[model samples]
Target: MQLSNIAHGPEIRDEAVAFCLWAPLHQRVTLKIEKRGQWQMKRLADGWHRVEIPGARPGDLYTFILPNGLEVPDPASRFQPNDVHGPSEIIDPTFAWRTEPWNGRPWEEMVIYEMHLGAFTEAGTFLAAIEKLEHLRRLGITAIQLMPLSDFPGRYGWGYDGVLSYAPDSSYGRPEDLRSLVDAAHGCGISVFLDVVYNHFGPDGNYLPHYAPIFSDTHKTPWGRGLNFDGAGSRFVRDFIIENAIYWIREFRMDGLRLDAVHAIRDDSHPHILCELAERVREAVSERPIHLIAENEDNNADLLARDAQGRARQFTAQWNDDIHHVLHIAATGETFGYYRDYAGDGAKIGRALAEGFVFQGEHMPYRGKTRGRPSTGLPPTAFVSFIQNHDQIGNRAMGDRMNASHPIEAIKAIAAIYLLAPQIPMLFMGEEWGSTDPFPFFCDLADELNETIRAGRKEELSRLPGFDVNDALDPICESTFRQAKLQWRGAIHNEPFVEYYRLLLSLRRKWIVPCLADARGHSAKYDSDGRLVCVTWKMGRSILHLMANLSGEAVDTTVPNRKDIILSQGDIAPDRLGPWAVLWSLAQE
Candidate 1:
């Protein structure tokens, strides 16, 4: 079995490198450390090679040598010399950590708040984000899921194009800034989850081919060629990736890693890279519980299934885009993308509650096949559901405002789905009080990689209707990211919106007893005509009914039992109102 090791180089000394390279077909592998003069190496066996390069360090460059004459550097190196075009550089993990040992909240108790740190603030540095941890904590969010911080080309991006796996993006401050962000977040009882892009590397900074065989033309993803996880010389490559996953949990003190686009990871292995990575992180965090959440669009419940003895080889959970599908269908009444299969979105919402999956193995007209399998027995905590996320917002032509499209009343209905439902609720940053920000897909690429990114973004958006190719590269100006920042002023002043979000978050934190039961009892009931759908939070004493008025006009709504007014986005908060008129009512038998 390949193990993790520490390697180093010059410019920085004794840098810790958890190195791995693809040399599977090769019986022997040699680690090479190159510096001022000639490079030196030591041969290793088991199709694996590892050694701590003592003198070599961060800013110093090095690569690996396989029996096949392939040379690569520590795949887990935080920094790469030559800007991802050259060998990997070591990064020391001994930076001062002030955050004491802190155990994170339960999966069911967690309210994940997703943010793109680069666009979350004006400065857009990790240090800048650190100043905002207390804000998220006060918002009733238990976890902060950050978009990718790994080094990508240029100043801005969606972070899916990261090339350097180990280092934090220079635009977001150095590695130390990221460490400070996580530590500070921990201090305020907020667990950090970095959305990691493992599917592919950025076009500009990517030069993995010169190091080892980590890319394969055989299996192409929607973005590009899939990672080389099972091919020849892939053992080391797999190790490099799996170790990088663990590096964040063990070293960076992150509570979890949100694996970006797991569906794009095509590996033909008996024990796939995903399984290996989960187990590796499990072992790495044996002393503390850490999460390895994958963002898989594959509506498969087996994606979260565990092995015997309750050891999860799969992901902790995935982003439930299906929830967005159902909510969008319910609110906007559109059936595009994977939402074509939803017969009744209100029922789909109910299915999300009862079964813990929205796309439950139904014939999906969008994919022309049965899409997700039924997850009847899984915990509601197995899925993170949200009405708006980066993908939903950024995929638009001008990135139209989410709250702008739907009525303020209907917007509250959508948020109530996640907060009231059993599934783990996630809020896109600025979603609480509805900050007017359009998170458009903007990236800064090197001059050489400009055409590559342009063509790639254009082709990807081409499938969508009426997508403008000219909009792919919107010019990565400061205004690009500036437009995405949250307007806390609006949230603070608007007592209604402020109280609305606070009420939802506080309500979720107060009554949603993850301990009472799993997501087994909740059932969604609604129709195609958009009349009424209900979210029933089943409890031992009282079952809560979350009713939504799909149409523009008020419609007569009914629940399982009597109701009372709890909250609403309409003109007046209902209190001691008639049965049908009560916007939010807590009732009993």
Candidate 2:
């Protein structure tokens, strides 16, 4: 078989299969057909040659012959066994998907619910995640952004360290299973946005270096070797990564992709990988709109900017960590890592509302550098804001939640600000009702990768405020996933939390005042010494003022008594709410 000339994913003939092998010093390589037994083929002169195998179709198993004559499974196989040592399964992407014309929700309308497939349910499979879609839909969520599901080694993982780009993590079920989940999510009127990692591959089960020069030794990232986007003979490597992105969106009928850690892509090409990927994806739609949301930290609005042409350039949106860090730390009082820079009473929250980013060009004491660029024109909706996401909850030393860290009323106040703000609000899986689970980081890896992860996690986490790697990877024996599961019954039994969430969702749909910022003046006000904050949400013709106190002590102030009092934080504050107070009112006559 011809290694380089072998038929690839889309450009394939039924009878032709190109076998790829990386001997680095090999003269010639051949493919060994492993249908029941091994069948050797003749070698070519130029390191690769092709011969049509008449009967070898999608299901027939195959391996490649090394220059040393050792045979191994297809290193870049779309499916793999339980571990790296296991057999590589043949997968055909021609499975039926029901969400053919699913073109994702608009950026302004997205209320994302971030979730981990494994810990999302007891089964932790694609089918398992499907069972809870109705809850998310009824909760006013427009999209489901799943954590990385790229196939990785071992039993369970967070899916970020996925090694195989094209394969869905078999630990979470098969390729068809993921397709069914996306199809089912679309059926429930919820778009599925998958989180994909293109910056770097997982440490384990990564065979790209074995078959091709996919990783560049030129520059190193925190996650080891960065992808060889612009290197010698890097055409195939670039195509491989981009094809994988297209595969998930097209093959599984995924509505969009939340590209993980795009800031690390570090491509210096004229047309960057991100821009190229975006162009091709929209073109593939043929008439449908596809979404590409970047999980970027650069804070450069140009990442979502459009060129002279009116094409949909850049990503649909990006994950705004500053907003959450500022608001969450203000409410929960956890000032460890980046949260240390967000202790401006309610001024931080106010700033985030007026501008989508809180730390835009601010000197960050934590990173010891000024972070983010000036994004004066960007709308708040382009950045997904949340009081709690998987990263925030999981990074905790003991996996404690904001609820466990602060009074429930404080959490409610945080919730009110995010839901009432102009930006799209996202909720971690159990964040709505305030689940008590600690989303501690855990991963199942092959022994080689597992040890690397443990050591690497230790080194990386040492920089965090109080993270202990030993405590984080404690075998998941403490029912970490169970604790993270959304206690549906608690939605009713825990009436206060339930009501708080319901009020937010209801207002998100009905509160036209905050629905859109229009041709009017808008700003968030703070009390005499920055103890309380009041935001005026004004569209073209609608306007309402939302107020909340972020301090422990309350002060008497001239709150507008002329307007209609629409909503309050809780029953405890019939007269005045102290810790976490919220209210909405219009200008009185």
**Model 1, span 111-198: residue lDDT tens:** 8889988778877888988877777777788889999887777767878888878777777776767888888888888888988988
lDDT of 2 by residue, 1-589 (tens): 0113443432235765444443343555566656554434454543333345555566555666656665555555666655554556666667676765566665556678889888888778888888888878877887898999877766777878777677677778877788888888888888888899989988777755764677876856778878887776555666666667777777777778889888888676657878777876766665555778887776777876644432337676788887888777767676776677787577777767666677778787887888887654555556678888887777665667787768876787778878766677888887887777677777766555556666666676677866655666453333654565555576556766766676687777666424454412333332324776766655445566767777667644555553356666643244454656677665422
lDDT measured at residue 443 in model 2 versus the true structure, 0 to 100 = 71
Alpha carbon lDDT of each predicted model: 0.68, 0.68
Q: TM-scores, in order shown?
A: 0.85, 0.88
Tally clashing residue pairs in candidate 2. 4
Off by over 4 Å in 2: 1-7, 10-27, 36-51, 70-76, 98-103, 306-312, 448-451, 466-496, 512-529, 537-544, 560-566, 571-578, 585-589
> Which candidate should be chosen as best, given lDDT against the real structure?
2
Report the C-alpha displacement of residue 127, candidate 2, in angstroms: 1.1
